[model samples]
Target chain A: MTEPAEPHAHQHESLPVAARVRRLEERVIAAGLTTDAEIDELLTRFYADAAPVNGARIVARAWTDEEYRDRLLADGSAAAAELGFGPQTSGFQLRAVANTPGRHNVIVCTLCSCYPLSLLGPSPSWYRSLAYRSQAVREPRAVLAGFGLDLPATTRIDVWDSTSEIRYLVVPVRPAGTDGLRPDELAALVTRNGLIGTAAV
Target chain B: MKFPPGSRVRARTTDPGHHTRLPRYLRGHTGEVVAVATPEPLPDDVARGVPEPRVEPVYAVRFHGADLWGCETGGHRHG
Candidate 1:
């Protein structure tokens, strides 16, 4: 594991762009300048004012409608358009990936938390923690175990570590006996961790 | 040209500039591109302290759970 450098010593102008950025981020996290609740408050305000809620509605509708789910998986942006999302500004394509018993899914941002806020709402602090990001790629089993997600030895562990160019979100499989649930009810089951593949409904 | 929506692509090693969205863990990892977001101007507030409009397209990708964390030696199945 790379030891975190002394924050004060790494100047943005001296280091490579990536390293500089990383060091700055590390400093912020190390300083504990932003509390989790404050971050959540920011996200809450951002989503409340932005189009994320609309995206979540689209996801919930798809959860209840199989045809919509097929369409969403086929053409995410188009399906999102059907629900009055992504028409002009804040252009984001929404895709929904189902996590079944056989195949599980998890998401991580190796860079920063480039989450799909449009559909999943705010990201949790753990999702942005250096511990989670670093450990996620190196020792996924141990990390998931910490999350109480113990997979069988046979299951292939595919980790999607995000880069600046791309982001990711997991569409946890709807819990059993939720076949007849409404969109609003299904939304309640979609926890933030569930969207990242750490927990399930 | 706009690639087909949901088309999966790997990041080229030569892409320039600051890339904060990509995680260090998945630098060379592979996954399916889930969606493409609208192009937005890069914010100057990035840790790099550079303020330039980005030309790269943003995407959402999916990775399998088992692919991330290895299967346990002798634990019960978890999804």
Candidate 2:
């Protein structure tokens, strides 16, 4: 195999975004502006508040109620606030997309992994990869199939490219055999991938 | 038009020196608006670290696979 081309300072092939973020964190620590404890605490709080559990809860609530579902489809951020997911400090916006028998929705930020971070916590590393960014829109059927979600060929896929500030949360179809499950139990079925439209709940 | 559902729009193709949210694959693609999204900060402003963010409307646009690829790509398998 031919050796890879030599990377230059201007080329980011040598230092990816993750490495840059880590280096920036090191500088902040080295500057003595904040301690690791504070950073860890903030990160913990962020994850706890914005994890997939929050999206699951929202989906479960929508599954159990019709009005809330309408509101969620109309204005995701406001409906999220009704369930105590208040407006984020950074003023991020969330939009909800529901899956129906005729259509399936998927999301991707091909520009740089711009996600519903306030609702979904940190995006998965897979979501940030260039493969996902470009292919999610170009070949959504194959991408979803790789994620273990085998939708029939009849289903029309609508790939939502988030090329702006609006972030999307997918409302996966409520699976069968869940007739007696409570809302929280139903929530337990929803995964981050489900909310991202890569997997079904 | 405000890009209401089913409204036709063409993605503007322009590579600038500043940060942008428009992806390369979608630069010249044509799509139809599916929904009107909440306004939020422009990606370039967010990247520049503006203290007060300027908000803009975001629309969910859907492009047809056949229109994008110029062929019937149904049975095409991906690697």
Candidate 3:
């Protein structure tokens, strides 16, 4: 007996976008513009090692080290390099915005999904969607609420629209009660959403 | 930096028929220069295929939500 059709199975492979991308890569390679190894090396260097955990490690270090926190707030790119995840790979400047009492920071690219990929991994699809790109700047409080984060009215929300080459990283306030936790332990508590300012740590 | 950190400036409203780093929503809106960003090649020139695009410092501007949306809402900083 034949199995029923599963339209969504292998959807990503069968998608038009994937086909177009493959075609483009094939054409470029056929033209001798680039080799497969070159493309794979570029991807491996830029994307393979990228993850939200990299950002968490930075936040964890900041929570544990006062001087490092100051350095991060002063110059984010340099501070990130100190932790081995620098903007050199991304070719974009990194800026860390820390959350404090009565103030919160969120990042959105109104033009496109400009994110610190070297530190935060790939940008979330929602972040790249038009709804999020527009609504995030217009109604951040409501957007944050939809993300299950309801900030008090008194809390000022500062949405950073990354229209330029500079990418933002939100340093969420260290959660209460975890004082004795080590950097690795604190890093475990740091979520991707926390790094994105969608959720707090 | 062309504008100091606290200098108030308005994003030019002139809509050039070419690529630009400034977004439409922020066009013609006034904001405070919060910081000086790295100097970048002018996008308009680069888009026009200028071999040598002029690089200039970009300012980080902070706009109040009340001003951008004409309501007492949240604020944003553009860079």
List the TM values for chain B, per candidate. Answer: 0.54, 0.74, 0.87
Q: For residue A53, give model 3's deviation from the true position in Å.
A: 0.8
Q: Which candidate is the best by DockQ?
A: 3
Better of 2 and 3 by DockQ: 3
Residue-pair clash count for candidate 1: 19
What does candidate 2's lDDT look like per residue over A99-191, in tens digits? 887778888776666688777778776777777766777788888887878788888787766654567899999999998999999999998
Q: What lDDT tens digits, residue by residue, belong to model 1 across residues A39-150?
A: 6798687677454345446557777888988887766667766776664213444445566676666776655565666556665666766677666666666777778887
For model 3, how does the per-residue alpha-carbon lDDT over A1-201 read when each residue is reduced to its tens digit?
112233223333556878999999999999999999999999988787888989999999999999999999888888999988755435877888999878999999887678887778887667777777788899999888888898999999999988546888999999999999989999999988899898888
Badly placed stretches (over 4 Å) of model 3 are: A1-24, A33-38, A87-90
DockQ, all models: 0.17, 0.26, 0.70
Error of 2 at A162 (Å): 2.4
Clashes by residue pair, model 2: none
Q: Ranking by DockQ, best first? A: 3, 2, 1
RMSD of 1: 9.4
TM-score of each: 0.59, 0.82, 0.88
lDDT of 2 by residue, B1-79 (tens): 3667888788788887877666655567777776776666766789989888777777667667787776423321100
